[model samples]
Target: MLMNTPKSLPVKVCKIESDARNTAVWVKHIQNDFEIIWILEGTGLHTINGEQYSLSQNAVYVALPGDYHELLINPGAQGYIVRFDTSRPDQVDSDYHTINESWLYYYFSKTPVLRLDAGKHDKMKNLIMLMEQESAAYSSLHSEINSKCLQLFQLYLRQHIELLSNPSCTYKMNSLLKQYFWLVEKDFKTQKNVEYYARELNVSANYLNHMIKRASGYPASYHIRQRLFQEARKKAQYAGFSMKEIAYYLNFTDISHFSKFFKSMCGISFSEYKREELKRAV
Candidate 1:
């Protein structure tokens, strides 16, 4: 019988190599962390967000924060389970941040499984092993070494995942819209208007807005505001930065303007939101 697991786990980076079926207990929990399960030798069932995936040798499964997942490992199944807290800024590299965002929006947003070929499987295995070794060594530089290894692992995994899952563009308009969304994610902080993005993509503003709305049910300006507001909310949570500093960071003309924008979009004053967040944390 499966048991309910805790809602959150302690923040850390750790790896375990196991062949034991008892590891299935991990699947019972929901964590506010990202996990990568590399199946070196296993045959079982993996489910994420109510979707079932066949677990087999050389397959990898990724779970994002708050995503419910389960693994039923059969007898004799073996694998490496790696987990790291997504909320820890000190442990995450900037490259990992970019890749994580891309994965969240592109791949993991839809599918959580990546089945790699033998060569790629072996390469990833080697990187995980190196990370495991460095983690166990506990040397003065162990954290740095492990972080670098994880960066390489993420880079390789993303490249192969893209190759495997690249969507066939049946319509050129779909491809163009995807490019426009990518640009919005990359430049939302400094550029918030549809005209700027349209000019950068070499299309007229009217056509660009039409295409984006047709594809995503939202206009291009909506995406820009959404991304900027997300960043603002994140920055607002940090106690170190004053509201004025956050407003400047997000390119708002003034603190009052930023506050008004935040309230309009988020339906709450910035101070009230932060206070609620603090209360929840306490």
Candidate 2:
């Protein structure tokens, strides 16, 4: 289940170290703020911006604004969800060298999940815990601590630049998937063809499909459809547009075509999915 919480703070920390209620089943949507999820224990799957990352102990997942992501955790999980606004200097210092001057955000934006060993994970968790305590006080010192802790976190990430950034096998496949995902996010609404993506990547459709499947365990077509479905689901649940208007906005030929695709991807009609979500919200 999903829970709605107040977003008044510059930095908010929710701990799941002892209780399951702290973790929420996040639905697919474009992120509106920065979120750092540090898993101290548990296993699950995290899908972010059309890529999937296996979740294990000490795995950290970062979600930036404009990225589509969903989190599914197995029962008995433990973690911390750290959310902070980028625009607020108190929460995240814009002048931080490790974050902006060193171009660490590029690496994070390209690949957001990082795997750490036990010792390093504990170090990162300590910072998160400090932020949590400071957030409770909401004093001037809290802002300073937030800046220092965030900068320290990014510095740590810069130290392990090559080791944990991609988490994939080869550099070549990682590069291909990154470009492919970027293109899909940019044009999934109007261009749903795998061949179009392949052409843009300067590879043949078959080779693109093969590499994507070998890396992500899903074909190029599946990723394309996943992106489309993500946007469709987000609109159906949150947008004010009618079904027909949504179809037109998504570049569907008509509502009929959109309805069929929605059913095939979602396993139910659009209205049915909305009703189920509404009941859960209540």
Candidate 3:
């Protein structure tokens, strides 16, 4: 993924790419833009924000903006990658950084990996292929490609609800509460601090706390623990990584600290989490 400029991002409305094979995608650390990887064939591993996973054929992984992740693609693996900018509609200077970042991270984390039916997979693949062909043709109807891309996105949403049976919404924020909830999930690891978010929103930490608590019947810290637990589960999925490696990889202050954090969040040690996750994977 490249982040030369904000305009380079073709998200918010539409984005299209085709035949993405044999491309060594080592770029990470993006300030803006969201990304979605739809695999058509083959297998590869992706490290998102320091966690890693093995992506099989015909699967999808959605990445939110500001997340620093990279991919290790194998030969012959092809997919369409998309990045959406959250700040597009919401002006950057209109609000505080912490509040904006929290909401941004929240929606960004909503995109979960989905395995689609063969027919659905073929449909998306064909749409991507057509977009590629249009790019090669260089027709004057350039807007057509963009329009087709939007159509493809709609079809994707349709399949997302009908085929996959996932009820999660896409891109747009439904409410301010839902928005901030997701942002905390996406950025808890890097930031680890939530009060800064309240401050940035120009509100008291107690106000943010009371708002999240009253709305969700839980404190804002719940989202922090939720994200940390998710990361711990992910760490359990990868093998051959030592305890210390996992700790540092997860940005824990130290092994002891990570152990405490894991236990505090999950009621188990890292080793136990790994064992359980492996058994579940099997």
Candidate 4:
């Protein structure tokens, strides 16, 4: 289950129009914040978490915190992109809070892409334009207005998400897995044990392992380790921190142990991984 915490919502909006002068080609990176990409025109390919998605006009894609995405836009592909930090707040409206929590725990956990109808697309586009204006105005109430706009945008997304969700699926199992993944997304950097997660979920370790394996085809520990490896690999490739510093930041006991773990899981040394990543960027 997702936690309810009050926090300020920080939102940033921008418009991208891909044409002769400005076409993005193979832009790939991991984001530290939540991102929503609303495609307005043309076609492209958007790959996230190693999954390729065909991007047509009106196709929306979301990248949650720690997700890696690549966008290669064809000429004339236009869209609005919104980035927001999902830091928990001290307080928020009960209804909005519930929706937000559900979104984090359920909707996004299911899929990163949502194709909107014309009406929904226009509504989202208008809201995003308003948010861009408010953000640029920098008035005394700019932050408040932007927050409200973002909440409205999220509500629209929630409605479509609910409509699109499959009712025939095993909801109980889905909920269990969503809760497990949510916990891993939040704590994987610091905690790496399946037992800890099982305890938090109020189930025995064996049962938790069984359920996760049954649902996802991987043991519960696999998800935890995958999350850790994702972060470690991203940091190793992109961040300026040294390997020792990266290991310490990720709560590893020492540099040697971290190196061994990385090689065992990833089949490459830290230096080799960085070298390959840099070459790919070029």
Best by TM-score: 4
Which tens-of-lDDT digit does each residue in 1-282 have in candidate 4? Answer: 111112333677867777655557656777766778777877778877656788877778887676677877778777787876656443234434344444443455457788787778777788988888876666777766777888899878766765765543223345556667767777888889998888998999999998877755679898778667877876776747679988998999878989998998889898888887777667
Taken over the whole model, the C-alpha lDDT of each candidate is 0.66, 0.70, 0.57, 0.71
Of 1 and 4, the candidate ahead on lDDT is 4
Candidate 2: worst-modelled 10 consecutive residues by lDDT? 97-106
Least accurate stretch of 10 residues (summed lDDT) in model 3?
Answer: 9-18
Please identify model 4 stretches exceeding 4 Å from their true place: 1-9, 17-20, 23-30, 43-55, 67-76, 91-178
Model 4 global lDDT (CA atoms, 0 to 1): 0.71
Candidate 3 has which clashing residue pairs, if any? 34-83, 34-84, 102-183, 105-183, 106-182, 106-183
Q: Write the per-residue lDDT of candidate 2 for residues 55-105, one digit (tens) a residue.
A: 878767888655667887767777888776655544455455224322333
Decoy 2 TM-score against native: 0.54
Q: Considering TM-score, which of the candidate structures 1 and 2 is the better prediction for this target? A: 1
- Candidate 1 stretches with Cα past 4 Å from truth are 1-23, 165-282
Model 1 weakest lDDT span, ten residues long: 2-11
Q: At residue 7, what lDDT does model 3 achieve?
A: 41
Sort the predicted structures by lDDT, highest score first.
Answer: 4, 2, 1, 3
Task: Name the lDDT value of residue 67 in candidate 3.
Answer: 53
Point out the higher-scoring one by TM-score: 2 or 3: 2
Per-residue lDDT for 51-136 in model 3, tens only? 67787877777565545467766666655665444444433222323333453344336444666666666667666556545544
